[model samples]
Target: MPTPLTPPSAPHWPAPVARTAVDATVALPGSKSMTNRALVLGALASAPVRVVRPLRSRDTDLMADALRALGTGVAEDGSDWLVTPGPLTGPARVDVGLAGTVMRFLPTVAALAAGEVAVDGDPRARERPMGPIITALRELGAEVDDGGRGALPFTVRGRGLVDGGPVTIDASGSSQLVSGLLLAAPRFAKGVEVRHEGPPVPSTPHLAMTVRMLREAGAGVETGENVWRVAPGPLLGGERIIEPDLSNAAQFLGAALVTGGRVTVPGWPDDTVQPGDALRGLLAAMGADVSLGPDGLTVRGSGTFPGVFQGLEADLHEVGELTPVLAALAALAATPSRLTGIAHLRGHETDRLAALVTEINALGGDVRELPDGLEIRPRPLHGGVFHTYDDHRMVMAAAVLGLAVPGVEVENPETVGKTLPDFTGLWTDLVRTA
Candidate 1:
């Protein structure tokens, strides 16, 4: 039997062990990133738009609710959302609820509203970085009252129009700074030109995803060396189908890697700007046989070449979200692995680096936190409570480890609701069938 998932306030939930090699096909939810982006663009369009296979999770739902609060119409049509753009008027309250995308992206949309909007979220949400986007907004001629904190619990005083033009921001903290500005750019009187002047932006794939989606919405976007420009124009509203979340698929495929079995994820997109597309290369480097065909993307493994037999040195700056799963796999690898160029992970849902190091170490594995990444030296892991720190990725990572190592308990297992609410159930079903 699978362990009972605990409530957020519960002490912990024991992670179930897979007694045998896992061999199952798991279908995953729609992409949270794509779903939210589509919602934002749909809300900005002049006519009604349709979003098919939208991820119905905490983050996406929060985005939909926030848009509804801002006078946008988001109604369900079976598995799709029919978004109708309306006059941007608001005396609204937005609860971002620890969703970084909502917190970062919606502020720009809110600035286009005609009234005051107050935005806040979970206590931890207040600690996440927002200054870069906020400062950039103020510089771009929007009135925002952050009370000098530059984070959340701020009020946006919108004047119904933004006098947007060229602006420069330090996006070293996050690529969302540029994306947030660009998403709202097309509505600006002068459009917007954004220049980044700081460390190399982490998660560049996410930035590209933002840009591609904007272009598809009929927005003119020019992206070059560390700069992005969007011309003011009407966003053409139409139907869009969200791709299955490859980031979540990584966890299932990683199960195959660790268990020496095979797992195939259907509906894998041949081309996508999702940062998770990097998984094909990353997993292949770890010695899995990865094949993408008309049927799906299949990852096959056996004991002969299980995980990176030799240690891996990888730069995950563009795909930092995959760090937790990679870190877990590295712990069980035959050789040590060094993952670098992801210092920005320190600013994610939790300080992911610190959380990974602590949780893995607590389970008797050797993982050292680097300033910019992690060094995992393979070690035999036992079982103990793995603290999730309210991060959905941490919950999934711990479940992956539990497949091989018994008695691993996961705290805040409910946190997976943020992105993959049915994570535990899907994992249990797959393991049982295997």
Candidate 2:
């Protein structure tokens, strides 16, 4: 197993409480989703490429390192990454940490290499769903040795090329399985056609994002009901500027609703496939004034204690990653909330539904775990410790709760380094401005 990134002795951080309405403009880092996808596409390109404003986090760093281990050149220039594609060869070992993207996405890239690539990750990572992708690889004409465990600690004994064709997989667990195959498909001898065969695949926005990036990189792609086709072709190499991670912007925006303050995030794209963009509608449903213009997305809360927001009922299937912060907001809302359509969350960094229910209830809230989602009924809350379970979003959720309920200590706040390395600092500044 890869060395655990979080030490058992990691200190807990006391989530800062907001004393007044916060009015601040927070600038966020680049998207981890985009950064990793860009890196993979760049490494498969016909020439060198530049990924501008890429996220500098553990997950993205692991992606860059994984590509480098497979003989790609990933050099840093200021805040950007310049990738030079080389012959894909490996006798390499990849430590995926706790990053789902690195574990699921890198294996396909490794399948294009000429030698053996051993892939493993942190202890919890071994428990995540990897069977679909592994099975898909074998069906697509690559050799994956999982020893029948169908999980991590696998080896891809690459023959330097995959004879890609139509293959079926049940991507209900995660969309990364589809993206992992699609991102590396352009390099396959015959490209690839992927068809989903089980329950509805979650996170459709992420799937769309993958397709968009592939096309932008010059690969011919087609999509239908439940299938994706990538034509065999050379990917163009050039500069690709990454957008600010709207998903990571969730907590900052949620803070506005919690404190009845105003928070603006700059560079909110006019058009994008990021699921985080759904926050505008979701927050509005819970009673927040939201606007987007040249100044970017701005959210203003009801400037009153307990703010004039009601509980929200929505299906988060396409935007499941937003559940943590949204759940925290639900616990503070004036009415009860029910968030559904995200059963796949059970496979995330932690069993998020259970974790949210347990942590919030520990703080004296009423959150019940549903089979598919959570039903949160607001209750008077008090200060207590909120365990992160090595999940970054869990830390984000705790921070949102602390704005109203004092003494919310988050275990292993450093786990936020998975995506947003400076989350605590940014959150502190936002609260301090209040």
* Candidate 2 global lDDT: 0.94
In order, the Cα lDDT scores of the candidates are 0.89, 0.94
- Candidate 2 Cα deviation (angstroms), residue 133: 0.9
Q: What TM-score does candidate 2 reach? A: 0.98
Clashing pairs in 2: none
Candidate 1 stretches with Cα past 4 Å from truth are 1-11, 303-310
- State candidate 1's TM-score: 0.96
Tens-digit lDDT track for model 2 on 67-110?
A: 99999999999989999999999899999998988998999999
Alpha-carbon shift of residue 240 in model 2 (angstroms)? 1.0
lDDT string, candidate 1, 61-104, tens digits: 99999999999999999999999999988799999999989999
Give lDDT: candidate 2, residue 34: 95
Candidate 1 lDDT (Cα, 0 to 1): 0.89
